[model samples]
Target: METNNVLKICPPEDSMKDCKTDIKCPIVNCDKVVFSSGSLRMHLTRSHGISESESDDALKRRIKVDPKVYKEYHCPRNDCLYNINSERHFTNMAGLKQHFLKVHAEKKFKCSKCDYGFGMEKDRKRHESHCGMKFTCTSCQCTYVSVEALRTHCNRTQHQIPEMYTK
Candidate 1:
Protein backbone atom coordinates (compact mmCIF):
# COMPACT_ATOMS: atom_id res chain seq x y z
CA MET A 1 0.00 0.00 0.00
CA GLU A 2 1.24 3.47 -0.90
CA THR A 3 1.01 6.24 1.72
CA ASN A 4 0.05 9.82 0.81
CA ASN A 5 2.48 12.43 2.14
CA VAL A 6 0.26 15.47 1.56
CA LEU A 7 -1.21 17.05 4.68
CA LYS A 8 -4.76 18.30 4.18
CA ILE A 9 -6.06 21.11 6.40
CA CYS A 10 -9.83 20.89 6.48
CA PRO A 11 -11.89 23.60 8.17
CA PRO A 12 -13.95 22.54 11.19
CA GLU A 13 -17.33 23.48 9.77
CA ASP A 14 -19.27 21.18 12.10
CA SER A 15 -17.46 22.43 15.23
CA MET A 16 -17.77 26.00 13.93
CA LYS A 17 -21.55 25.57 13.92
CA ASP A 18 -21.38 24.49 17.56
CA CYS A 19 -19.00 27.37 18.27
CA LYS A 20 -21.76 29.72 17.22
CA THR A 21 -23.54 28.71 20.43
CA ASP A 22 -20.59 28.36 22.84
CA ILE A 23 -16.81 27.96 22.76
CA LYS A 24 -14.89 28.32 26.00
CA CYS A 25 -11.23 29.18 26.33
CA PRO A 26 -8.77 26.29 26.61
CA ILE A 27 -6.83 27.93 29.50
CA VAL A 28 -7.78 26.50 32.85
CA ASN A 29 -9.74 28.66 35.36
CA CYS A 30 -10.68 31.02 32.48
CA ASP A 31 -14.49 31.31 32.35
CA LYS A 32 -14.53 33.30 29.10
CA VAL A 33 -17.09 31.94 26.65
CA VAL A 34 -16.44 33.09 23.10
CA PHE A 35 -18.73 32.58 20.12
CA SER A 36 -15.95 31.84 17.60
CA SER A 37 -12.54 30.20 17.54
CA GLY A 38 -10.85 33.49 16.54
CA SER A 39 -12.41 35.30 19.50
CA LEU A 40 -11.34 32.46 21.83
CA ARG A 41 -7.79 32.73 20.50
CA MET A 42 -7.80 36.52 21.07
CA HIS A 43 -9.15 36.01 24.60
CA LEU A 44 -6.40 33.51 25.34
CA THR A 45 -3.70 35.96 24.23
CA ARG A 46 -5.12 39.17 25.75
CA SER A 47 -6.78 38.01 28.98
CA HIS A 48 -4.60 35.02 29.91
CA GLY A 49 -1.28 36.49 28.73
CA ILE A 50 -0.79 33.60 26.30
CA SER A 51 1.67 34.39 23.51
CA GLU A 52 0.47 34.44 19.90
CA SER A 53 2.69 31.47 19.04
CA GLU A 54 1.10 29.38 21.79
CA SER A 55 -2.42 30.25 20.67
CA ASP A 56 -1.40 29.58 17.07
CA ASP A 57 -0.09 26.15 17.95
CA ALA A 58 -3.29 25.29 19.81
CA LEU A 59 -5.35 26.61 16.91
CA LYS A 60 -3.30 24.64 14.37
CA ARG A 61 -3.85 21.46 16.33
CA ARG A 62 -7.59 22.14 16.35
CA ILE A 63 -7.94 23.42 12.77
CA LYS A 64 -5.18 21.22 11.20
CA VAL A 65 -3.05 23.58 9.06
CA ASP A 66 -0.34 21.59 7.33
CA PRO A 67 2.67 21.45 9.62
CA LYS A 68 5.01 21.31 6.62
CA VAL A 69 3.67 24.63 5.33
CA TYR A 70 5.73 27.17 7.28
CA LYS A 71 3.69 30.37 7.54
CA GLU A 72 5.72 32.67 9.82
CA TYR A 73 4.92 36.27 8.97
CA HIS A 74 1.50 37.77 9.75
CA CYS A 75 0.01 41.27 9.31
CA PRO A 76 0.02 42.85 12.78
CA ARG A 77 -2.49 45.56 11.83
CA ASN A 78 -6.01 44.58 12.86
CA ASP A 79 -7.58 46.91 10.28
CA CYS A 80 -5.76 45.25 7.36
CA LEU A 81 -8.51 44.02 5.04
CA TYR A 82 -6.32 41.83 2.81
CA ASN A 83 -6.76 38.03 2.58
CA ILE A 84 -10.16 37.69 4.20
CA ASN A 85 -10.80 34.18 2.84
CA SER A 86 -7.33 32.84 3.63
CA GLU A 87 -5.10 33.68 6.60
CA ARG A 88 -3.88 37.30 6.51
CA HIS A 89 -0.28 36.09 6.59
CA PHE A 90 2.88 36.57 4.49
CA THR A 91 6.25 34.92 4.03
CA ASN A 92 8.14 38.12 4.97
CA MET A 93 7.74 41.72 6.00
CA ALA A 94 8.81 42.93 2.54
CA GLY A 95 5.84 41.22 0.90
CA LEU A 96 3.47 42.75 3.49
CA LYS A 97 5.04 46.18 3.00
CA GLN A 98 4.68 45.92 -0.78
CA HIS A 99 1.03 44.98 -0.39
CA PHE A 100 0.48 47.98 1.90
CA LEU A 101 2.20 50.36 -0.54
CA LYS A 102 0.24 49.07 -3.53
CA VAL A 103 -3.16 49.09 -1.83
CA HIS A 104 -2.94 51.95 0.71
CA ALA A 105 -0.37 54.41 -0.69
CA GLU A 106 -1.39 57.56 -2.54
CA LYS A 107 -1.47 57.43 -6.35
CA LYS A 108 1.54 59.12 -7.97
CA PHE A 109 0.11 59.81 -11.46
CA LYS A 110 -2.50 62.57 -11.57
CA CYS A 111 -4.49 63.31 -14.74
CA SER A 112 -4.37 66.96 -15.87
CA LYS A 113 -7.82 66.71 -17.50
CA CYS A 114 -9.73 65.39 -14.51
CA ASP A 115 -9.51 64.35 -10.85
CA TYR A 116 -8.54 60.76 -11.75
CA GLY A 117 -5.27 59.45 -10.39
CA PHE A 118 -3.31 56.24 -11.06
CA GLY A 119 -0.42 54.34 -9.50
CA MET A 120 1.11 53.33 -12.85
CA GLU A 121 2.08 55.20 -16.04
CA LYS A 122 0.26 52.69 -18.26
CA ASP A 123 -2.95 53.12 -16.31
CA ARG A 124 -2.66 56.91 -16.64
CA LYS A 125 -2.07 56.62 -20.37
CA ARG A 126 -5.14 54.40 -20.71
CA HIS A 127 -7.22 56.99 -18.86
CA GLU A 128 -6.19 59.76 -21.28
CA SER A 129 -8.29 58.21 -24.10
CA HIS A 130 -11.51 58.78 -22.21
CA CYS A 131 -10.46 62.00 -20.45
CA GLY A 132 -12.75 64.15 -22.73
CA MET A 133 -9.71 66.04 -24.15
CA LYS A 134 -10.65 65.45 -27.81
CA PHE A 135 -9.64 68.39 -30.07
CA THR A 136 -12.63 70.71 -29.70
CA CYS A 137 -12.85 74.32 -30.98
CA THR A 138 -14.82 76.26 -28.37
CA SER A 139 -15.32 79.33 -30.64
CA CYS A 140 -16.84 77.43 -33.61
CA GLN A 141 -18.37 74.64 -31.47
CA CYS A 142 -16.59 72.21 -33.89
CA THR A 143 -14.62 69.07 -33.02
CA TYR A 144 -11.47 68.05 -34.93
CA VAL A 145 -9.73 64.72 -35.26
CA SER A 146 -6.32 66.17 -34.33
CA VAL A 147 -4.83 69.13 -32.45
CA GLU A 148 -3.01 70.31 -35.61
CA ALA A 149 -6.34 70.57 -37.46
CA LEU A 150 -7.88 72.52 -34.57
CA ARG A 151 -4.85 74.88 -34.49
CA THR A 152 -5.12 75.41 -38.31
CA HIS A 153 -8.82 76.28 -37.95
CA CYS A 154 -8.06 78.69 -35.09
CA ASN A 155 -5.27 80.41 -37.13
CA ARG A 156 -7.35 80.68 -40.37
CA THR A 157 -10.60 81.87 -38.71
CA GLN A 158 -8.82 84.02 -36.09
CA HIS A 159 -10.97 82.22 -33.46
CA GLN A 160 -9.41 82.52 -30.03
CA ILE A 161 -9.21 79.06 -28.39
CA PRO A 162 -8.44 78.38 -24.77
CA GLU A 163 -4.85 77.34 -23.93
CA MET A 164 -6.16 74.01 -22.66
CA TYR A 165 -7.49 73.14 -26.14
CA THR A 166 -3.91 72.98 -27.60
CA LYS A 167 -2.98 70.23 -25.21
Candidate 2:
Protein backbone atom coordinates (compact mmCIF):
# COMPACT_ATOMS: atom_id res chain seq x y z
CA MET A 1 0.00 0.00 0.00
CA GLU A 2 1.23 3.45 -0.89
CA THR A 3 0.75 5.77 2.08
CA ASN A 4 0.82 9.54 1.93
CA ASN A 5 3.63 11.20 3.86
CA VAL A 6 2.35 14.69 4.50
CA LEU A 7 4.97 17.22 5.43
CA LYS A 8 3.76 19.71 8.01
CA ILE A 9 6.49 22.35 8.15
CA CYS A 10 4.91 25.48 9.48
CA PRO A 11 3.31 26.41 12.83
CA PRO A 12 5.75 24.72 15.16
CA GLU A 13 4.27 24.98 18.61
CA ASP A 14 5.99 27.30 21.14
CA SER A 15 8.30 28.68 18.43
CA MET A 16 6.59 31.61 16.76
CA LYS A 17 9.71 33.41 15.63
CA ASP A 18 9.46 34.32 11.95
CA CYS A 19 12.47 33.07 9.95
CA LYS A 20 12.36 36.12 7.62
CA THR A 21 13.08 38.51 10.51
CA ASP A 22 15.91 36.55 12.17
CA ILE A 23 18.81 36.97 9.70
CA LYS A 24 21.33 39.66 10.63
CA CYS A 25 23.35 41.74 8.18
CA PRO A 26 26.81 40.10 8.00
CA ILE A 27 28.72 43.24 7.10
CA VAL A 28 31.05 44.63 9.77
CA ASN A 29 29.75 47.30 12.15
CA CYS A 30 26.23 46.69 10.77
CA ASP A 31 23.56 45.67 13.30
CA LYS A 32 20.67 45.24 10.89
CA VAL A 33 18.22 42.35 10.54
CA VAL A 34 16.28 42.14 7.29
CA PHE A 35 13.44 40.14 5.82
CA SER A 36 15.28 37.79 3.39
CA SER A 37 18.47 36.96 1.54
CA GLY A 38 17.31 38.94 -1.47
CA SER A 39 16.72 41.90 0.85
CA LEU A 40 20.15 41.43 2.43
CA ARG A 41 21.77 41.15 -0.99
CA MET A 42 19.94 44.28 -1.99
CA HIS A 43 21.10 45.90 1.23
CA LEU A 44 24.69 44.98 0.43
CA THR A 45 24.29 46.45 -3.05
CA ARG A 46 22.49 49.65 -2.07
CA SER A 47 24.07 50.43 1.30
CA HIS A 48 27.55 48.90 0.96
CA GLY A 49 27.97 49.21 -2.84
CA ILE A 50 28.78 45.46 -3.00
CA SER A 51 28.20 43.71 -6.33
CA GLU A 52 25.44 41.10 -6.35
CA SER A 53 27.54 38.70 -8.45
CA GLU A 54 30.30 38.55 -5.87
CA SER A 55 28.16 38.84 -2.73
CA ASP A 56 27.31 35.14 -2.27
CA ASP A 57 30.87 33.80 -2.01
CA ALA A 58 32.12 37.03 -0.46
CA LEU A 59 29.34 37.10 2.14
CA LYS A 60 29.91 33.46 3.17
CA ARG A 61 33.65 34.04 3.43
CA ARG A 62 33.05 37.14 5.49
CA ILE A 63 31.04 35.14 8.03
CA LYS A 64 33.81 32.51 8.34
CA VAL A 65 36.54 35.17 8.30
CA ASP A 66 34.75 37.23 10.93
CA PRO A 67 33.24 35.62 14.03
CA LYS A 68 31.35 38.78 15.05
CA VAL A 69 28.96 38.45 12.13
CA TYR A 70 26.23 35.76 11.98
CA LYS A 71 25.19 33.27 9.28
CA GLU A 72 22.40 33.50 6.69
CA TYR A 73 21.05 31.12 4.04
CA HIS A 74 20.37 32.76 0.71
CA CYS A 75 17.20 31.90 -1.10
CA PRO A 76 17.75 29.56 -4.09
CA ARG A 77 15.12 31.41 -6.08
CA ASN A 78 17.08 34.32 -7.54
CA ASP A 79 13.93 36.00 -8.81
CA CYS A 80 12.44 36.24 -5.29
CA LEU A 81 10.98 39.64 -4.48
CA TYR A 82 12.83 42.54 -2.88
CA ASN A 83 11.09 45.85 -2.24
CA ILE A 84 11.81 49.03 -0.28
CA ASN A 85 14.74 47.41 1.62
CA SER A 86 12.65 44.37 2.62
CA GLU A 87 12.26 40.90 1.09
CA ARG A 88 12.13 37.16 1.87
CA HIS A 89 15.10 35.44 3.59
CA PHE A 90 15.95 32.66 6.09
CA THR A 91 18.42 32.25 8.95
CA ASN A 92 18.97 28.54 8.31
CA MET A 93 18.90 26.17 5.35
CA ALA A 94 15.91 24.39 6.91
CA GLY A 95 14.04 27.67 6.92
CA LEU A 96 15.00 28.23 3.29
CA LYS A 97 13.79 24.72 2.38
CA GLN A 98 10.57 25.35 4.30
CA HIS A 99 10.05 28.62 2.46
CA PHE A 100 10.67 26.94 -0.86
CA LEU A 101 8.39 24.02 0.01
CA LYS A 102 5.57 26.34 1.06
CA VAL A 103 6.02 29.06 -1.59
CA HIS A 104 8.06 28.04 -4.63
CA ALA A 105 7.34 24.30 -4.76
CA GLU A 106 4.13 22.92 -6.22
CA LYS A 107 2.21 20.67 -3.79
CA LYS A 108 -1.23 19.47 -2.86
CA PHE A 109 -2.35 19.48 0.81
CA LYS A 110 -3.97 16.13 1.55
CA CYS A 111 -6.20 14.89 4.34
CA SER A 112 -4.50 12.24 6.50
CA LYS A 113 -7.80 10.40 6.94
CA CYS A 114 -8.84 10.14 3.30
CA ASP A 115 -7.93 10.74 -0.35
CA TYR A 116 -9.27 14.31 -0.30
CA GLY A 117 -6.70 16.93 -1.34
CA PHE A 118 -6.55 20.70 -1.52
CA GLY A 119 -4.27 23.32 -3.06
CA MET A 120 -4.10 25.26 0.21
CA GLU A 121 -3.37 24.10 3.79
CA LYS A 122 -6.15 26.19 5.29
CA ASP A 123 -8.81 24.46 3.17
CA ARG A 124 -7.54 20.99 4.08
CA LYS A 125 -7.46 21.82 7.80
CA ARG A 126 -11.00 23.19 7.64
CA HIS A 127 -12.23 20.08 5.89
CA GLU A 128 -10.41 17.69 8.24
CA SER A 129 -11.90 19.36 11.33
CA HIS A 130 -15.37 18.03 10.54
CA CYS A 131 -14.51 15.53 7.78
CA GLY A 132 -16.21 12.74 9.71
CA MET A 133 -19.61 12.79 8.01
CA LYS A 134 -20.18 9.04 8.29
CA PHE A 135 -18.55 5.60 8.16
CA THR A 136 -20.38 2.28 7.77
CA CYS A 137 -19.42 -1.14 9.15
CA THR A 138 -19.58 -3.86 6.47
CA SER A 139 -19.92 -6.74 8.98
CA CYS A 140 -22.70 -5.41 11.25
CA GLN A 141 -24.17 -2.89 8.80
CA CYS A 142 -23.86 -0.30 11.57
CA THR A 143 -23.31 3.38 10.69
CA TYR A 144 -20.83 5.61 12.54
CA VAL A 145 -20.46 9.39 12.47
CA SER A 146 -16.66 9.15 12.34
CA VAL A 147 -13.93 6.65 11.49
CA GLU A 148 -12.72 6.62 15.11
CA ALA A 149 -16.20 5.69 16.31
CA LEU A 150 -16.48 2.98 13.70
CA ARG A 151 -13.06 1.56 14.64
CA THR A 152 -14.06 1.55 18.32
CA HIS A 153 -17.29 -0.29 17.53
CA CYS A 154 -15.42 -2.85 15.43
CA ASN A 155 -12.89 -3.49 18.22
CA ARG A 156 -15.57 -3.85 20.91
CA THR A 157 -17.85 -6.10 18.86
CA GLN A 158 -15.01 -8.03 17.10
CA HIS A 159 -16.97 -7.50 13.87
CA GLN A 160 -13.89 -7.27 11.72
CA ILE A 161 -14.21 -5.71 8.27
CA PRO A 162 -11.76 -6.43 5.47
CA GLU A 163 -8.55 -4.41 5.46
CA MET A 164 -9.58 -2.64 2.24
CA TYR A 165 -12.97 -1.70 3.70
CA THR A 166 -11.39 -0.45 6.97
CA LYS A 167 -9.20 2.01 5.23
Candidate 3:
Protein backbone atom coordinates (compact mmCIF):
# COMPACT_ATOMS: atom_id res chain seq x y z
CA MET A 1 0.00 0.00 0.00
CA GLU A 2 2.22 2.71 -0.93
CA THR A 3 1.31 5.05 -3.92
CA ASN A 4 4.12 5.95 -6.37
CA ASN A 5 4.80 9.75 -6.96
CA VAL A 6 5.19 9.03 -10.74
CA LEU A 7 1.43 8.23 -10.91
CA LYS A 8 0.74 11.93 -10.10
CA ILE A 9 2.08 13.44 -13.34
CA CYS A 10 3.09 17.16 -13.67
CA PRO A 11 4.00 19.48 -16.59
CA PRO A 12 7.77 19.62 -17.46
CA GLU A 13 7.87 23.48 -17.44
CA ASP A 14 5.53 23.98 -14.47
CA SER A 15 8.29 25.94 -12.64
CA MET A 16 10.83 26.39 -15.44
CA LYS A 17 10.60 30.24 -15.25
CA ASP A 18 12.44 30.15 -11.88
CA CYS A 19 15.05 27.74 -13.33
CA LYS A 20 16.44 30.28 -15.84
CA THR A 21 20.28 30.47 -15.91
CA ASP A 22 21.76 33.73 -14.44
CA ILE A 23 25.22 33.58 -15.99
CA LYS A 24 27.56 36.51 -15.15
CA CYS A 25 31.24 37.48 -15.41
CA PRO A 26 33.68 36.46 -12.65
CA ILE A 27 34.62 40.16 -12.19
CA VAL A 28 32.28 43.03 -11.17
CA ASN A 29 28.52 43.04 -11.88
CA CYS A 30 28.63 45.08 -15.09
CA ASP A 31 25.94 47.16 -16.79
CA LYS A 32 25.25 44.41 -19.35
CA VAL A 33 22.67 41.84 -18.18
CA VAL A 34 22.76 38.67 -20.27
CA PHE A 35 19.99 36.05 -19.80
CA SER A 36 21.32 33.01 -21.66
CA SER A 37 24.31 31.09 -20.23
CA GLY A 38 26.04 30.95 -23.63
CA SER A 39 25.21 34.59 -24.59
CA LEU A 40 26.55 35.91 -21.25
CA ARG A 41 30.06 34.77 -22.24
CA MET A 42 29.74 36.37 -25.69
CA HIS A 43 28.50 39.68 -24.18
CA LEU A 44 31.42 39.84 -21.72
CA THR A 45 34.09 39.49 -24.45
CA ARG A 46 32.26 41.50 -27.10
CA SER A 47 30.62 44.35 -25.13
CA HIS A 48 32.41 44.39 -21.76
CA GLY A 49 36.18 44.44 -21.28
CA ILE A 50 37.51 41.00 -20.32
CA SER A 51 40.97 39.56 -20.96
CA GLU A 52 43.18 36.66 -19.86
CA SER A 53 45.28 37.32 -16.71
CA GLU A 54 48.36 35.74 -18.26
CA SER A 55 51.44 38.03 -18.70
CA ASP A 56 53.22 37.98 -22.07
CA ASP A 57 55.99 40.42 -23.16
CA ALA A 58 57.48 38.21 -25.90
CA LEU A 59 55.87 39.93 -28.91
CA LYS A 60 56.91 43.42 -27.73
CA ARG A 61 59.79 45.04 -29.61
CA ARG A 62 63.06 45.30 -27.64
CA ILE A 63 64.84 48.69 -27.56
CA LYS A 64 67.67 49.23 -30.05
CA VAL A 65 71.26 49.44 -28.77
CA ASP A 66 74.84 49.76 -30.05
CA PRO A 67 76.59 46.65 -31.47
CA LYS A 68 79.24 46.81 -28.69
CA VAL A 69 76.52 46.74 -25.98
CA TYR A 70 74.52 44.06 -27.85
CA LYS A 71 77.55 41.76 -27.68
CA GLU A 72 77.28 41.54 -23.86
CA TYR A 73 74.09 39.58 -23.05
CA HIS A 74 73.76 35.80 -23.68
CA CYS A 75 69.92 35.44 -23.44
CA PRO A 76 68.61 34.27 -20.06
CA ARG A 77 66.19 31.65 -21.45
CA ASN A 78 67.53 28.89 -23.70
CA ASP A 79 64.32 28.96 -25.78
CA CYS A 80 64.77 32.71 -26.58
CA LEU A 81 67.26 34.31 -28.96
CA TYR A 82 70.77 35.07 -27.56
CA ASN A 83 70.55 38.60 -29.04
CA ILE A 84 69.78 41.47 -26.61
CA ASN A 85 70.28 45.25 -26.42
CA SER A 86 72.45 46.01 -23.33
CA GLU A 87 73.38 49.68 -24.02
CA ARG A 88 72.67 51.58 -20.76
CA HIS A 89 71.75 48.52 -18.64
CA PHE A 90 74.03 46.90 -16.01
CA THR A 91 75.76 43.99 -17.72
CA ASN A 92 76.36 42.37 -21.13
CA MET A 93 76.77 38.70 -20.09
CA ALA A 94 73.88 39.01 -17.60
CA GLY A 95 71.30 37.31 -19.89
CA LEU A 96 72.95 33.91 -20.39
CA LYS A 97 74.51 33.89 -16.92
CA GLN A 98 71.14 34.68 -15.32
CA HIS A 99 69.44 31.83 -17.20
CA PHE A 100 72.16 29.25 -16.45
CA LEU A 101 72.14 30.27 -12.78
CA LYS A 102 68.55 31.45 -12.08
CA VAL A 103 65.81 29.73 -14.13
CA HIS A 104 68.00 26.63 -14.69
CA ALA A 105 68.53 26.19 -10.90
CA GLU A 106 71.71 28.22 -10.26
CA LYS A 107 73.10 29.34 -6.85
CA LYS A 108 71.88 32.60 -5.26
CA PHE A 109 73.66 35.90 -4.65
CA LYS A 110 74.04 36.65 -0.90
CA CYS A 111 74.65 40.20 0.29
CA SER A 112 77.76 40.54 2.52
CA LYS A 113 76.46 43.68 4.28
CA CYS A 114 73.06 42.25 5.25
CA ASP A 115 70.96 39.09 5.28
CA TYR A 116 69.45 39.62 1.81
CA GLY A 117 69.66 38.15 -1.68
CA PHE A 118 68.17 39.25 -5.03
CA GLY A 119 68.34 38.04 -8.61
CA MET A 120 68.61 41.59 -9.98
CA GLU A 121 70.53 44.73 -8.86
CA LYS A 122 67.32 46.81 -9.22
CA ASP A 123 65.75 44.73 -6.43
CA ARG A 124 68.79 45.36 -4.20
CA LYS A 125 68.62 49.12 -4.88
CA ARG A 126 64.87 49.19 -4.09
CA HIS A 127 65.57 47.53 -0.70
CA GLU A 128 68.05 50.32 0.15
CA SER A 129 66.64 53.34 2.03
CA HIS A 130 66.13 56.78 0.36
CA CYS A 131 68.64 58.36 2.84
CA GLY A 132 65.82 60.56 4.28
CA MET A 133 66.18 62.86 1.26
CA LYS A 134 63.14 62.39 -0.99
CA PHE A 135 62.77 64.82 -3.91
CA THR A 136 58.94 64.87 -3.89
CA CYS A 137 56.84 67.14 -1.62
CA THR A 138 55.54 65.50 1.58
CA SER A 139 52.57 67.91 1.90
CA CYS A 140 50.78 67.37 -1.46
CA GLN A 141 52.78 64.29 -2.60
CA CYS A 142 54.09 66.24 -5.64
CA THR A 143 57.16 64.71 -7.29
CA TYR A 144 60.38 66.76 -7.64
CA VAL A 145 64.00 66.05 -6.74
CA SER A 146 64.74 69.28 -4.80
CA VAL A 147 62.98 72.23 -3.14
CA GLU A 148 64.07 74.39 -6.11
CA ALA A 149 62.65 71.77 -8.47
CA LEU A 150 59.34 71.74 -6.60
CA ARG A 151 59.21 75.55 -6.75
CA THR A 152 59.79 75.41 -10.50
CA HIS A 153 56.99 72.83 -10.86
CA CYS A 154 54.57 74.93 -8.79
CA ASN A 155 55.41 78.01 -10.89
CA ARG A 156 54.58 76.13 -14.12
CA THR A 157 51.36 74.52 -12.76
CA GLN A 158 47.92 75.86 -13.81
CA HIS A 159 46.58 75.74 -10.21
CA GLN A 160 47.65 78.55 -7.88
CA ILE A 161 49.32 77.64 -4.56
CA PRO A 162 47.07 78.35 -1.56
CA GLU A 163 47.97 81.33 0.68
CA MET A 164 48.43 79.08 3.75
CA TYR A 165 50.92 76.86 1.80
CA THR A 166 53.28 79.76 0.90
CA LYS A 167 56.86 79.05 2.16
- By lDDT, the best candidate is 2
RMSD to the hidden true structure, all candidates: 18.5, 17.9, 27.3
TM-score of 1: 0.26
Which model is ahead, 2 or 3, in terms of TM-score?
Answer: 2
What would the per-residue lDDT of candidate 1 be over residues 57-127, giving only the tens digit for each residue?
A: 65644554455554434333345654423454565434544444345445666877786775444456677
Model 2 error, position 23 (Å) = 25
Q: Model 3: number of clashes?
A: 2
> What TM-score fits each model?
0.26, 0.26, 0.21
lDDT of 3 by residue, 99-145 (tens): 33333331244444564664434334554433234455445768653
The TM-score, computed over Cα atoms with residue i paired to residue i, of candidate 3 is 0.21
Worst 10 residues of 1 by lDDT: 10-19
- Candidate-wise lDDT, in order: 0.57, 0.59, 0.40
- Candidate 1 segments whose C-alpha is farther than 4 A from its true place: 1-78, 83-102, 133-167
Question: If the candidates were sorted by their lDDT against the true structure, best first, what order would they fall in?
Answer: 2, 1, 3
